[model samples]
Target: MVKVTYEIVPHDGGWAYKLGDVYSETFASHDEALEAVRIVVQEQQVGDEPVEISYQDESGKWREEYSDGGDRPEVEIIDRFRPGEASV
Candidate 1:
């Protein structure tokens, strides 16, 4: 199964969670960021019927394929910050 990681980090004078090179909206506090990630995690676990999908990959090629909605990737969150440590 594919494993996806969301990492919390400092962004734009606030906090945000990022997957790969993409980031969510910045939050005013780390707790808010954590809450947002939790909500997304819950949503990602819901399953549906298999369906056809299409997308352009990094190589700039458009591809189409069928995806088993139940084949969702294992998702995780990584927060490097400790209570009193500097933010990353």
Candidate 2:
């Protein structure tokens, strides 16, 4: 199983959560960002029909692959900042 993590971080003068290079929209506050994470994780748990996916590699080659809808990565959250320190 693939393990995924959402790390809370300061971004663009606001708070956000990021999974690898992907980031959620900036929220006005840390609590708001956390709430967004909760929603996204919930959606991630829902299964869907398997589908073929395409993506570009680092070498700029396009690749197609099949993804199993039943397979969901285990999610983790990391929030290192204390309440008042979250502001960017």
Query: How many clashes in each candidate?
Result: 0, 0
lDDT, model 1? 0.85
TM-score of each: 0.77, 0.71
Cα error of candidate 2 at position 31, Å: 0.2
lDDT of 1 by residue, 1-88 (tens): 9888898889999999999999999999988998898889888889989999999999999999998888877887888864542222
The lowest-lDDT stretch of 10 consecutive residues in candidate 2 is 79-88
Name the weakest run of 10 consecutive residues (lDDT summed) in model 1.
Answer: 79-88
